[model samples]
Structures are given as C-alpha cells and as structure tokens.
Target: MLKVLIVDDDKNSREVIKLALERIYEVEVALNGVHALELMKKNSYDVVICDYVMNEVDGIEVLKKMRKSGNNAVFILITAFGSSDTAIKAIQEGAFEYLSKPFKMSKLKQILAEIEKSLSEKKKEEAVETNKDFEDEQIIADSPVFLEVLKQMARIASSDVPVLITGESGVGKEVVAKSIHKYSKRKKGPFVAVNCNAIPPSLLESELFGYEKGAFTGADKSKPGYFEQAQKGTLFLDEIGDLEFDLQVKLLRVLQENCVRRVGGMKDIKLDVRYIFATNVDLEQKVAEGKFRADLYYRLKVAEIRVPPLRERTEDIIPLANYFIKKYNFYNREIRLSQGAERLLLKYRFPGNVRELENIIRASLIKARYTGVIMPGDLGLKEEHIKELNREEILDALKKAGNNRKKAAEILGISRATFYRLLKKFSIE
Candidate 1:
C-alpha cells in the first residue's frame, strides 16, 4: 500500500485529509515540521501533504529542512496564498502539486493518481536489478573499449570521489553506475537514481531537497529528498547535464558542504553519500556554451568514464546479442537464436547501442515464440529499415529493375552480397 504523511496545524483539516486518503493510502499525520521529521526518521512514507502556514515553522521552511536532510518523498503543498510567485516557488522547491485552501476533494484525488503513476514507473525501473546482484569482480569485456572502461571503473570505485559517466543514450550508463556502487564500501546501503532530465525544473529542487509541511500553498506534510534516502550509499544522478542552472548552484553547495536543507526548513542535515552522475551530452561543450557550470563539472568529473558507442565497439556485437538472446529466452521460456539470425544481427549498426540490441533480441524472441530456432525473418528487419536507404527511392528502383535483385542492387549502389542480405531481410526470396 502507498504511504502518505499529512502535516497540518488545523486538527479538522488533518482529519479530513486522513479520512479521504485512508481509503487509498496508509496515512500518518504531524502537527508541525519537528514532529513530522521525527516520524520521517522512524518510517518511510511515499507522499507528503503539507499545509503552508503554521506558528513555529512555515511550509517553505519545512521543505528547506527536508531537502537539507536528503529525503525524497513526493510532497504536495496546500496554502491559501494563491499568488503566482508562491506557486512557482512551491514547485521550484519540489512540491509535486499545489492546492489552494477550500479546494474540491476530487482535485486532491487527481494529484494522488499522478503520484501513483510516478511511483509505478519508479518501481518498474528499480525492478531491473539489485546492488547485490551486481558482481564486484565481474570483468565486462566483450570489446577493447569496454575493457578499458572497466579498468578505469575499478580505479575510481576504490575511492570516495565523485564520478561522471559520459556516453551516448542507452549505452548502459546506469548499469555502470550500479557496478561502481556494488564494488564500493557503501554497497550495503540503498542505491537511488534520479533522472534530472525527466523531472521538470520547477519540481526538481524540491524533489532533491525535500519540503516542510505548511511551507507553501499545498504542503500538507514534511518529506525528505534523494540526499537523505541515499545516506551512506550511492546517489546516481542520470542526465546531469539537463539540471537547471539555479539548482546546479544549490547542488554544488550540497556537494561542497556534504549537507542539504529542506525546502522550507531551517536546519542543515549532514549526509555521507557517493555521487555518481551520468550524461550522454558533452559537458565540456555545455560549459563552454554556458549551458553547464565549469566548477560543477570539475567537481563531478573528479573521476570520469566514457562508454563507447555500439558502433565503436563492434567486436562486442555478437556477444551482447547472444547474451540478450539467452536472457530473454529464460524470461520468455522460448527457443534460442539461430545461427542465421545471429549473423543478421552482426551486420546491423545499432544507433541506440546496447538498449537497441536488447530490444531487437526481445522482439525476435516474441516472433520466434515457442519455436526452438530464431530465424533472421523473426527479427522483422525490412529492406527499407536498413540504413542509407530511402523508402520512396528504393521502391521506385525495385519497380524499374522489375524486382530483379542484381539490377536493383546496382541501382541502390550496394554490392550483390549486401543485396542478398536485403532480399532475406525483406523476405523477397
């Protein structure tokens, strides 16, 4: 069941929200930020609803305090202050959603629904693997480039320095990050990953720092952010290049001070965490272009590892393909890839890298079904799907050549060997 923490000074308001949400959530409540923090330290909650106004601590202060502590629960702020600036500030602090006083119960329900969706997505991503499942002494070397990267990873994993992994999209950066955490001394703690690009800039800060109850318009309770959740563990920041400029400064401060302040709270919470960040973009170029900060780059790149693209590490193609084939075969309880299918996969250049290779193998498995041999046709690689071929021109040429393989191959500017491959690809023969 989803857990919700409610913080409101008014007894009536707290009870109303608790009753309404209890049907769908396991609800907890606190009269103020201090009590909320005490409760948070003892238990983990999924969502927090905080009121914006209180005598001792306001909603923003609560958020600031939560962030400093590094808790990352979803926070929704409720306030009577309906100004645009307040809303923007609340969102910037990481309130999942803001609600005004005297709002309809239906609106609150809708926000909860969104939270459920977000939680579901998070669970799906987390289901990939656990830290224990990662092999500490595993040598992932199907290619020279990967071998070099593994060597570097070993050196970096031995220390407590921050590491920034740069690579193309879908190149297994997360897998690499997990491997680092698994090899590190802090392997026993939680490994939390936050996708900076996936969350909006307005909510990114609060999501990272956390918020106090009654900090803004719709904060019903206090909550923690990633920094707190990853205490004595590794925090993987994916797509670090996409972080907003203002948040970047705050993050730099946290890294430098080794502490965080929640969105509306007054105290700083010390943290011991290993920061592992990954980005597909060129951070140096981004810094030069003023899109990324130079100082922050230096701090994060104290250790750097770059993952080679699939095309650059072509030697790994067959191994990776077969690995995926075997992996999916177990999951799907299906036949293995045939020799012909493996050859076809070897010829393709996967722009999407390892992720693309995994998907291809999965698709082939489905097409092969319970059949023991996965054929090249099961991959569904159409002639036009092959790179360097425009659909219209290829169709026109095929018509002009009267569908003759040799002539069409000539007009298409590819060798007959390649043409035969295309014929088998399109199932023309």
Candidate 2:
C-alpha cells in the first residue's frame, strides 16, 4: 500500500479523509502544514493531500519548500475557496491534482485508485530497470573504460578473495563493493558497511570486534560487532586508508586467521566474512610514509579494481545528467536537456565527480519546475550565444524553423524543452 498524508486544520475534515483513506493507504494526518512538513523529514510519503487554506504555513508554501528540498511525492491540493486562478497556480506549482471542498468520497477513491494503478505499472516496468535514466545504481555509465570496469567486477564477484576498490571521491567505490556481494555465492548473506574515517579511532576497535557484557562502562549487554554482524556475507570497509596503524595489525590478523576476539572476551570466534576495501588515497604511499601498515596494504590489494573519475569519461556526462533529470523530474511537462545545456555540462570539469553532477542535475530540475526545460541558468552557467534572445526573436526563430522542435531549439539557442516552454508562455499552441 502507498503511504499517504492528509493535512487539514479542521479536525472533522482531517478525520473524514483519514477514515476514508486509512484502510486503503498507510494514512497519516497532520493538523496543519507545519506539522505535515515536520513529519515529512522523517517519512517518505507516496502522496500528500493538503488543504490549501490554513491559519499559518499554508499548503502552497509547504509545497514550494518540499520541491526545493527534493521531496518528489505527489501533492494533491484541496480548498473550499477554489477558483480558476487557484487551479492554475496549483498546476504551476507542481500539484499533481486539485480538489474542491465537499467533494464526493467516490471521487477521492477514484483518484486514489488511479494513483495506485500508475505506481503499480511503473513498479513493474522498473523490476528490470537498467542502463536507462535511473541512477539508483552507483555506477551507471556507458563509457568503454567504465564498461571494462563492470566486466572486471562481474568476473571477480564469484570468488571469496579480498578486493580493493580504489577511486577518487564520489567515484562510487562502495557501490562496487555492494555489486560484488550481490553476485557472489553469498548473495543471500548480509552486507555490512563502514567508513573507517567516519568513526573516531578511540571507539573504532570496540565497534569492529564487538564486546562482551560489562566490557566497558556502557556495555550492559553482549553485542556482536561489525565482524560478527557480517558473518557469512560481505563487509565493505570504506576509506580503509584512514585505519589507524595500530588497528591495521588487528584487521590483518582477522584476514589471515578468519577469526576475531571480542573485547573483554577470552575465546576467539571464527568469522566467514568476505572483505571489500575501498579508499580514495594511495595506500602504497601511506605505507611508505609509515602511516599505514604495509602488510595490510598488500593483503587488501590481492584483487584491485580502480574506477576512473567522471571527467575522464566525458561521454558519460549527458547520460548521467539525463538519469538525474528522470530521477527528480516531477512536473506535468517532460523535461529535456538542450544542446546548449549539454555542451555547458560537458565543458565543466566536475571536481566532485558523479556526486557533483547529480547535485547539479537535481538542482536544475527543481529550478525547471515551471519551464519544464533545463537551461544554462538552472545550472548557474552563462553563454553569450543566446544572451540576447527575446520573446519576438524566439517566436521568429520558431517560425523560421517551420515549427520543427530541434531546428527551433537551434535557432533560439535553447533546448527543445525550452522551446516548448516558450510556446506555452506565449500561448502559441
């Protein structure tokens, strides 16, 4: 069942919707938009049915904030004070549906059924989604070099050998680790992950090896550490280069012996975990500098896989941008990247790699809510070619292109989506 939230200031109205939807959906009710937004931060709702009129923090303000912050749930606005202007503003602000107060229960159910059916069909389509516009997979690229990396990863996923994944930050090292576990014989086993740099060094040992009851002041009960937690599965150790020199010896021993001794415990426990290590730094250099253990470095490098930075694979940029566009695009109109937008995206050197590219596209999508077109301005980019284009110039360019979308975009120095947006803005069609 899809999760739904109903926000209304009137208690009776809230109960009416809540009672109507609770059996069909995982329904939640909030007294007003502020309470609804606070709950939004903690839960992912499939649909938000909000009242347009409220004492404070009205639904429109909540909707704008939600879109700005990347919440892509379907929003249905209901108001007793409905008018053509209210409906138009709702559509412009990305409301999926609008309802007038005192509407029939059957109408609401019909809308709910439609939402459910659409979501079910999309879920079916995505059961085997791959290499399309979706970006849930950490590594989604068509570059020849990246394809070779995938081939290598697929081949290496079957073995129990220790794997070292090296790459620049945001190059998706952890994603590679998860893929290894997903294809291995231990695919059904748990996959545990940790960042060596994230946890403080003082607490890292107890966290890794676990501890017995009363092992420390706060150790009231026995707990299995990351090792035991990952038993019979994969354990991804991210940023392994940040491991303290002292703890490196213990980690090496566990790798060598396949056993661990819990803190304050006398007996050693055998472990069956497959180790996958990732780092953005040079482990060899760290060893040479006497900051990291040379033995551990060599041990982790038994099977090494290196990922190239995003800038190195220029061909993947457009596909990646389109992927993010599909991910965060929620407007009624279809959004597309202009040739100009693509050129500018390709021209920039993404110092933060794929993560930065994702951020840029997500932000652009939010900015393109009204236009349904990602412009250079959405990406904070500037180009001289189209700086002087005006409404008449754009209309004249469209007329010159014989109303062809691609040619019109070329003439106006914008993307096809932008051309369509301009047509709507001018009421041309």
Candidate 3:
C-alpha cells in the first residue's frame, strides 16, 4: 500500500486530512515540522503533505530539509494564503503539488488519483524495460544525472517523435539512439544507421533514395535505399548537421511528405519509419550560419536529448571502466583495477567521454595481458597523471585541513560541494 505523511500544527487539521486520506493511503500524521522530520527519517513515504505555516518550522523549511536529505517522496504544500510567490516557493522547494487551505476533499482525492495512476504506469513501463538485457545499448552509470538521462530516454521511447540527440563527439549519441530504437515499439524492425558526412554528395542521393537499374553508371540492378530498407523501423542519421545544403532540402521534403523518391523513379513511395538524428556539432549554429536548412533543423529537433560528457558526471567513470574491462577480457582472467589506478583514472579528465574510457580500459587490459591487477602505468595517462601524484595534492590538502571539505576545496582551487562530489565519485570515505 502507498504511504502518505501529513504534517500540520493544528491537531484538528491533521485529523481531518488523515480521515479523508486514510481510506486509500496508509496515512501518518505529525503535529509539527520537527515531528514530521522524525517520522520522515523513520519510514519511507510515497507522498508527504505539510501545512504551510507552523510555529517551530514552516512547510518550506521542512520540505527543503527533506530534499537536502535525499527524500524523493512527492511533497504537497497546504497553504492558507495562496499567492504566486507561495506557489513558486513550494515548487522550488520540490513540492509536487500545492493545495490552498479550505479546499474540498474531492479536489485532494482527484490529485491523489492522478499521482497513483502516473506512478502505476511508470512502474509497469520499468518492469517491461527491466526484462531486456539491452547489451548493445547498455548505459553504464551510477550518477543521478546519467540515470535521469536514462529515464528521459525511456519516456521518449514511447513516442514515434523524431529525436535529435545532441552531444560532443564520442559521447555515445549513437548508443542513445540505438537504445531508443530498442525500447521503442519499433524494436522488431530494422535499425539503419547513416553517416551524413561519410557519403559523397553525388552518391548520397542514390544511397538515401534508390535509382532505377539504368539510372546511374553503377546502377546495374535496382536496389532499395535506407528509408525503404528501414520501413516500419528506425533510421538513425548520424552527424546530420554536416549534410549538404541541397541534400537537406530533399531530406526535409521526405520528412514533410513521409515518402521517398527514387533517383530515377517517377513517383514517391510512402514510408513508415521513425527518424532519429544525432549530431556532435551545433546544428542551430549551422542554421544561423546559413550552412544548414532552417526547416530541416526544426524538424530534426522535434524531440532533443543531450548525452552528457564524462568529465561533468564523474561518478560514471569507474562503472564505465569496469564495463569495458569485462567486455574486452576475452580469457576472463582476474584482471582488476588497483586503488592507485582508480585514482589516476578518476583524476584525468576524459575528454572523449564513454568511448575514450572504453578505449583506455581496452588498452590497459591489453597492456596488463589479463595477468593480474592493472596499475597506473597500464592506464597510459600522461602529464595529468604526474600532476595527480603530487605530494601537496587535493587529497593531502584534505588530510591537512582535517578533512574540512571547504578548506580542502579552496586548497584544490574548486568549490566545496565539488570537493565533496569528487570524494563520493571516487568512493573516498
């Protein structure tokens, strides 16, 4: 059963809310903010409803405290004097919904119904997703940010909207596209990948839209193109920002018409394919520069997903490294990462994101030859490794400051929260 915690200074208000919700939710009541916090720490709740005003602690403070403590329960604020400022504050403090006091029990019930239905659907989708191995589209990450990205991917997969994946080169944009296709309803169909820049302009036309048997020099036999081949499937166009201007017009026409024309054929053939475009470059910038078509850019960006680079989300470093280690370890020997090696890998900025991490792990494993533990030397880190090994480093600074994170962050030329975040990323106690 779903649980809800109610916090109100007034005993009568608390009792009324409990009575209204107890029929459906397993309701717990708290007299004030302090009591509410105590109850929150003691038990897990699906939802929390707190009164806006109280003597010891206000609803905003209680909500902030709960959020800072990593409580993800849905919070609803009950306010007597509702205003724009109050509503904004409640939302900013992570309240899922706010109800003005003296509101009907029916209204509250309606909101609860919506929340329950939404949670139920989300759970069902997750259960279906969890059954798939998704090896090729495996996303290795423990960071909250990256996990949210995965969740966004799942939500986007339920639709056939064209998705434009944006990220730096080697940040796994293609992997994200493939994952979307696998999770989507079109999973049973083909997944065709096309590199827009890789194909020559003269041939790209024929490559994307097939020609008649006698249309071109090498067209001895009529063959279907990418769009035709990806019928009822997904067509992933990678680096689409680099597509030529003239070809962009043709592609836009195809998108607008939902059909393709053979290079020499008379009529257009209707298509039923989901389009997923990915690019490392800023297509918006290209559009501004008049290097790309404005209409095509708009069409491609119908639903955009940004794949974050590795350096920003440091928590993914270790897991991605381990994944690659297991991937390339053909002999399945006991090759493991040493503490020093882990430190070095985390310290060095992975400019190449997941791809770079995988490459590093592969090279390191090959250097180690699956004999035993992989050391810092196996990582092939250059000057960055030397800088990380300095005696008067951030780690030493932390020790000197008696593990005072603020002073350690100042010593390391970074923010205090960043220092703490790095500590957690590296699994430093």
Candidate 4:
C-alpha cells in the first residue's frame, strides 16, 4: 500500500484525517511541521496532508523544504483560513491541492481516489515509455551502410567519450543513441533524452540547469534540472544545433567543469552523466556561419556517428516496413506486402526516412487488415510525391501508347497493375 503522512497542529484534526486515510493507505500522523519533517526524513511518503497554518514551521515552509530535498510526494494543504489568494499561494508553493475547512469528508475521499487512479495511470505510461526506450535499441539494420553505423556505435559504446549523431530528421538518430546507451557499461543507468529545439529557448536554460526555491518569480520550491536528473545516466541532447548561443556557452562550461550549478544555487553539483548529442543540421556549417559555437561543437563531436538517410539505404525499406507491420500487428493479422507495393516502395525515395516508413506501414496495415496483403495504393504514398508522375504525365503516356494500358505502363516505367490502380485513383477513364 502507498504511505501517507498527515500533519496538523491540532490533535483532533490530525487524528481525524489519519483515521480517514488509514483504511486506504499506510497512514502516519505528525503533531506539527517539525514532527512532519522529522517523519519525512525517516520515511518515504507517497502523499502529505498538512494544515496550512501551524506553530514553529508552517505548512508552506514544510512543503518548500520537502521539495528542496527532492521529495515529490503529493502535498495537500488544508486550512480554515481559506481565501482565493491563500489557495493560489499554496498551489504555487507546490501543494497538489488546497482544501478549505468544513468540506465534505466524501469530497476528500474522492480526491484521494482520483489521485490514486492518476498515479496508477502515470506509472503505466512510464512503463510504456521505458519499454519503448528498450525497443529503440532493437534497430533494424539490413543494409551494409547501416551495419557500419552500428559498428561505430559499438566502438563508441566501449568508451565514455561524448557522441555526436548527425542524420536527417527521421533517420533514427535517437534510436542509435539509445542503442549506444544500452550496449555501454552504463547500460544499467537511466537514459534521459532532451530535445533542445522542442523546449522554448527562454525556459530551456532553467529546464536544463534547474533552479533553487527563490531562483526567480513563481519558483516557490527548488527543482532539479535535466543535468541533475541524468546523473549516473546517459543524457541525449537531441537537436543540439538549435540550442541558443548563450546556453551553448553555459553548456560548454558545464562540459569543461564536469558539474552543474542550478540557476540560483550557491554550490555546484557534480555530474556523472554520459553526453550524447544529435542534430539534423550541419554543425560545422553553423559554426562557419557564426550560429553554433566551434569549441562546443568540437567538445560534443568527440566521437561522431552519421546515420545514413532512408533514400541512401533503400535496401532496408521493405525489411523495416515488414518489421513495423509485425510490431503493430496487435490483432495478429497475417499481413504481408504485395510485390507491387514492395517495388513501389523501392522505386520511391523516402525523404522522411525510417519514421515515415513506420507510419506508412502502420497506416497500410490498418487498410490491408482484411485483405492480408498491402497493395501499392494502400501504402498511402499517393499524398505528396505521387505527383512526380502527374495526371498529365499519365495522359501523355496513354496518348503515346495509343490508349493501350499495358503499353502505357511500359511507357511510364511501372507495372500494368500499378497503371490500372493509378487510372482508378485519378478517376481517369
């Protein structure tokens, strides 16, 4: 059972709350904040229910201290002196909920039930995410070029040097990074992936470096940043090319010092994080253009691995497609690709790379579920690049072939079945 701590100055109030929660959780009572903090240091709590107003140390102070110490237990502050401002302040101080006195006991119980359900769901999601990270290491490398990239990853995994993975946007750079982490000595540790471009440039620094309780406005409690969280683990910084110049300098400093200081923190916390950075953009060109820092680029590029794009490694397309089909075959449908579909896939260049192929497979599998065979039309490659052989081009081919479909197929460099599908798709008579 999850553990809960109830802290109230009044003995009656403390006992009442404890008695109510004891049936659902392993409950503990504290007379005041001092006692609660003492109990906290000794025990791990999943939730903390504390009165807002108390003697010696108040509830807000307790909450702040707990957060500072990195205890992420759900805190709910109850108070008789309730106001909009007080509730807001409590929430800003990191209280999960601020309940006014004289509320229904049933209401509190409902809230607890909701919290429990949400926590369970959160755990499930985390498990799925962790499982995905493990799955990412299971890369499909049928092509000789991709196999060489895997070899480089293995060589890089043996040492602790920083890695810079350069590839196109959907070429599975992060997957390669995860595979490296999985094969490394630090395989047992966590792998934290942060997308530099995804986070806003303004908040990215604080998010990356963390901040103290009074770091800035609304920072009522201390929080550890990504650097601190990734200690004893691998920190994969994706899209490092998009990092701001100022943060780049700070990052360079962190790399050089092997430690990080929170935004308003007085002392530096040493890090044992293995760094892996990835970018689709050319960092050397960015350096030449004065966008990216040369020194930081050099620091991160200690061991460089460039992933070949899908177009460059077309040999892996059908195998990767089949792999994705099997992965998404949750209903265990006997799905297979048509020869025409395989030829279509090989003939077309996948500018979006493996990610696109997976999406295509997922969508195609759904469309072909009943048939057990994914056709060229089911692959949904008709959206963008299908325009390469436009309606006019087909018409021209038909005109040149004297309106014979088979002759037109020959003229257009496609199979007769594909030509018929295109005619039906474009509603050409």
Instruction: Report the number of the highest-lDDT candidate.
Output: 4
Ranking of predictions according to lDDT: 4, 2, 3, 1
Query: What digit string (tens of lDDT, one per residue) describes model 1 on residues 266-338?
Result: 9999999999999999999999999998999999999999988887887887767656665666422335555
Model 2 spans with C-alpha error above 4 angstroms: 1-135, 330-333, 381-429
Each prediction's number of clashing residue pairs:
52, 0, 0, 0
The total of clashing pairs for model 3 equals 0
Q: Candidate 3 — worst ten consecutive residues by lDDT sum? A: 125-134
Model 2 score (lDDT): 0.81
Shift of residue 366 alpha carbon in model 3, Å: 1.1
Residues 117-230, model 2: lDDT tens digits: 445434443221234535466567689988988998998998899999999998878878998999999999999999988999999999999999999999999998999999
RMSD of each: 22.0, 13.6, 22.5, 20.6
lDDT for each candidate structure: 0.78, 0.81, 0.80, 0.82
TM-score of each: 0.59, 0.61, 0.60, 0.61
Off by over 4 Å in 3: 1-134, 384-429
Give the Å error, residue 232, model 4.
1.0
> Residue 361 of candidate 4: its Cα lDDT?
90
